[model samples]
Target: MSADPTLQVSVLLPVYNAGRYLPEALESILAQENICFECVAVDDGSTDDTADILNDFARRDARLRVLSRPNTGIVGALNDGLALCRAPYIARMDADDIARPARLARQAAYLDTHADCVGVGSWVDYLDPEGEHIWTWKMSANPAQIEHDLLEGGIGGLVHPAMMLRADAIRAVGGYQAECKDIEDYDLFLRLLEQGHFSVLPEPLLGYRQHPASINATSNRGARTAIANRLMAEARQQRGLPEKVLTPTPATPESSQLEWIDLALLDGNWRSARKTTCRLFRSVPLKTAPWQALGKLIQAALGKLRIRAGRIRQFVSIF
Candidate 1:
C-alpha cells in the first residue's frame, strides 16, 4: 500500500485472467496527464501471465502497486483493493479495458469542483475483440436524469469501470455487496445514491472490449430481470417512485446456443464451434442451432479442401 499523501485519486483495477489486454489497459492509465494518482491493481490469482505483467508494470511505475493473491474471485479482489485505496477519490478500471488518457485528470477535476457529487462516471465506447468501435453507452449528465433512467427503465445509469467516486462515501456504503453478483455495479449505485448525487461526465473516457466469454455473453437474462423487479419493488415501496421493468423477450436455449456457435465461428475457434454444435444436437424440439451448425461444419470442410488442393497443385508444379 504505497499511497501518496498528495495523491488526489487511487484507481482500483482488479485483474483476473486478463493477460491478453493487461498491458494496453495499464499503458492507457500511465498516459494520463497532470493527474496525481495511484493504480492499486489486485491480481486475483490469474492462471495466465497476468501476475508477471502486473509486477513488471509496478516495477516500472511507482504509482502502480500489484497485489498477488490466490483466486478469491472478483468480489474478494474488489474488496481487497477498496480497503487499500487511500485517496480522497477512487476510480475503477477493468483489466480488459483501456482508460482514455484524459480520463483520470478530468474525473479528478470534476470531483474537486462538485462538492455534492459523490461519484461521477463517463460514457463508454464499446469495442469488439478486434478493437473496432461498435457503439457507445451514452450515460445521462446530471443526477436527476440518471436517477430517472434508473427508476423508469431499471438501468443502473452508469458505466461501472469508467467511474471516479469519493472514497469515504463508498466505504460508508460498505463497498460492493457479494450478493449483487452479476449486477454488483447497479447495487453499489443504489446504495451510494442514498447518500449523495451520482452523475456522468459527457466525455467518452473508456474503451470496453467485448469477447465471446465476457460478462455480457455469460449473464443470465432471467437473473437480470429479477434484479430489475427487485429494484422497482424497492423504489415503489420505499420512495413511492413510479418505476416499470421493461422486460425484453427471453432468448430460447436453442437460439442462444446458436448465437454462441456463430460467435465461435466469427472468432475462428473451431473447438468451441464443434462443442456448441453437440449441445444444439441434444436440445429438445430441434432449433436453428442444428441448421446453423451444419452450414458451419460444411464451410469448414470446404475451407480445408481448398487448402489441400492448393498444396497439391504446388507439389505437382515442383515435380
Candidate 2:
C-alpha cells in the first residue's frame, strides 16, 4: 500500500486538435503545490500540432504521460484515460480551460477531510478568448439543494473541468454513460450525486475559455436535450425517486415569469428583475391573473428591499 494518505489524483485531459491551449493547461496542472498527481494527456488523434505538443510535454516531465490514439470523440477519449489512470482519485481538466495552480491541492484536502464527499468542484470564472471576465458561476454547496435547483434548469453548476472524482465510485456508477455522449459530465454528476455527496470550494478554481470555435458553440442542441431527458430518468430511478418528484411543477406564464424575477432578486440583479416584474404587471390582466400578478408585485418589492439591505450592509461593513 502506498504510505501517502493524501490521494494521488490522476489529471485526465483529453486533447483533440487543441494545440493552442494545451500547453498552458498542462503547465498549470503540473505547477500544483504540495500534491502528488499524474497528468495523463490523451491525444485523440489530432490532425494539428496537438500530438507534437503532447510529445514534448511527455518527454520533459516523467509525471506527464501521453496516450496517442486514433480519432475519437471527447467521450471516448475521457473513457480511455480513466481506464489507464492508476490513482485513487481522478481530476478532469479540459484542454481549453486553465486550471488554477491550487485547484488539485485544495480539492484533495477537501476530500481527505470529508469522507462522505465522493466528488468535488469549485466556482469557475468564464473568460473570453482575450481573457476578459464574463461572469462568476457559484454552485450550490448542499447536495439536496443542488439536485432541487437542477430540476428547474441546468445542473452544470459545478463545471466539469474543475471536477475531481473518486476513481472507484465513478467506476461503480458504470463510468460515463454512452447514451449521454455530449452531456456526459452532466449525466455522471447526477449519478455521482445519487451515490454520494458533493463539495464546492466556493472559489474560482478554473478559468473556462470561451471562443467561437469551441465545441459547445456548435454542439447539437437537440442531442443534448435528448441526453438530458435520459439523465433525469436514470437519476430518478437510481435514487428511487417518484416520477412526480422529478416532474417540474406546471406554472402559468405569469407565475413562471415570477420565478425568474425571484431568481434575479436573490442574485442581487434588481433593475432587470424590477423591470420584468413591472412589464408583467402592466401587460397581465388583473382579475384573471390576480394571484400571479399579485405574487410578482410582492416579489418585486421584496427584491428591491433585498437590494437596499445589501447596499446598507456593504456600507456598514466598509465603515
**C-alpha lDDT of all candidate models, in order:** 0.80, 0.76
Model 1, 1-319: lDDT tens digits are: 4545799989999999998989999999888888888889999989999999999998899989888899887878899998888888999999889899899999999988999999999988766555655456676787888876666645545888898999989889898887767777777777787778887888789997766557766678678668767866676557776655657546555655566556656655666667667656776435566877778778977987999999999999998
Task: Predict model 1's lDDT versus the native.
Answer: 0.80
Tens digits of per-residue lDDT for model 2 on 1-319?
1323444889989999988888888888888888898888899989999999989988889888889999878888988888888788889998988888889989988988888888888998765555545456787777767676554337747678888889889889888776677788888887777568877889999988765456565566566766677667666666586553233343345554455455555655555455555656676756444456457557668877899999999999998
Candidate 1 worst ten-residue window by lDDT: 248-257
Instruction: State how far residue 234 of model 1 sits from its true place (Å).
Output: 2.2
- Candidate achieving the largest lDDT: 1
Q: After aligning candidate 2 to the native by TM-score, how far in Å is the CA of 268 from where it should be?
A: 12
